[model samples]
Target: MMRATTAAAILLLATVAKAEDSLIEIVTREVKGCMDSEHLGSIGGLRSYNDPNSAEQKCFLGCMLKKFKALDADGQYSAEGLKTTIQHCPRMKSHPDIQKAALQVADECNGKVTGCSDYCSCAPLAAKCLHEGMKNKSFQTIFIALDEALDKMQS
Candidate 1:
């Protein structure tokens, strides 16, 4: 019985490690696609996130979405996809789409998103913007609070 339990534990560990690795790969690929399609090597607009004024963060996200939509018309936020993603990510919260994409991964594969899917709205191209946006703490702070407010309103 001890040996069986040990083997099962090892198997679970291996599975978890593999899942993490797969999620990383998926994120990397998606981000790369976003960067390539959008021609956005780096965003100069996101530098003010630490300045205490959270407005820039919101503006940056909005601008990024427009640019992304222009680059990949197929990736446009459908009314349904936007609603679902918003429901999952709650837009008032900073990077709602980014949060949605991340949560989409969590939802689709037990916290491991290996590829884009119906739930995960961030396509190969849009994921890059999300990854970049998340690095700004100011944005996160405002976004999180906003998410709480929005969630409450919705509820």
Candidate 2:
């Protein structure tokens, strides 16, 4: 009975390991597809973010962008990228250019952000907002309009 129990445990462990491996494979393939897609722009920009000394970091970030289509030229940043940025980058933001790029990418995933209104669903509007903000334009006009429309919310 003890031997039988041991064999059962081994089988269970092997099955769990196989499941994990399959998940990794699926994720990697998805990322590869996104990276190779023509819509996705040059991944050269993102390549700089990964630590040169850490192969794992490099692979992880690359896989992330590729899987989610965040590097797409036409602003195809996947829901994953936006969710990640909104959750993580708010405090630990990096280079200005990267921040801007991240915002732009997040704009592409506007639909996924919880509580983000439908009015801001379109990418063009979000792109315009990000572009103008990045350009150092005083958002006075927009701020005033929003303040007036939603006075308490602005506070």
Candidate 3:
């Protein structure tokens, strides 16, 4: 009987560990997909934010805001819309840290230079400010409860 019990416990532990690993895999894959070559133009890639002044970096951040629905048609901000968009990222949508970082990005970088007269300003300011607010490491680490981050971001 003791032998049976020990075997059962070992199986349970293995199952739990496998589940955790799977969860981490899902989140990592989903987030990486966003900045893949296809979408890098919009969302800054790994370390792309380090040089916030570059035109590519600027557009990267600005386009990411647009993609995330943080910016509306007129370039204004909508918290609700932003939340909706963030949900696309598996496990990250409802995370408090992500919400805080996103809000910071919205408040400070949303319209930094989005006006028509200063169209060029939008990219640099948005990218720089957003990069400062949302680091890649923070993004990966915030969604601790991998199960919660299971939903794939809407395409």
TM-score of each: 0.25, 0.22, 0.39
Write candidate 1's Cα lDDT for 8-39 as tens digits: 11110111133445323432343344445544
Candidate 1 positional error at 134, Å: 14
The residue ranges of model 2 lying beyond 4 angstroms of the native Cα positions read: 1-35, 39-84, 90-125, 137-155
For residues 62-120, could you state the per-residue lDDT of candidate 3 as single tens digits?
Answer: 44444445445554544455555444444343354555555555555544535432212
Model 1 misplaced stretches (Cα beyond 4 Å)? 1-24, 43-77, 85-155
Model 2 lDDT per residue over 1-155, tens place: 01111111111011113444533344334434544543343333232221223333334343343332332333343445444533343221433444444455455435432332222122323333433432343221111211121232223
Clashes by residue pair, model 2: 31-67, 40-72, 41-73
Ranking by lDDT: 3, 2, 1
- Choose the strongest candidate by lDDT: 3
Q: What lDDT score is found at residue 17 in candidate 3? A: 36
Query: Which 10 residues in a row give candidate 1 its minimum summed lDDT?
Result: 4-13
**lDDT score, candidate 1:** 0.31
Ranked by lDDT, the better of candidates 1 and 3 is: 3
Task: Quote the positional error of residue 57 for candidate 1 in Å.
Answer: 13
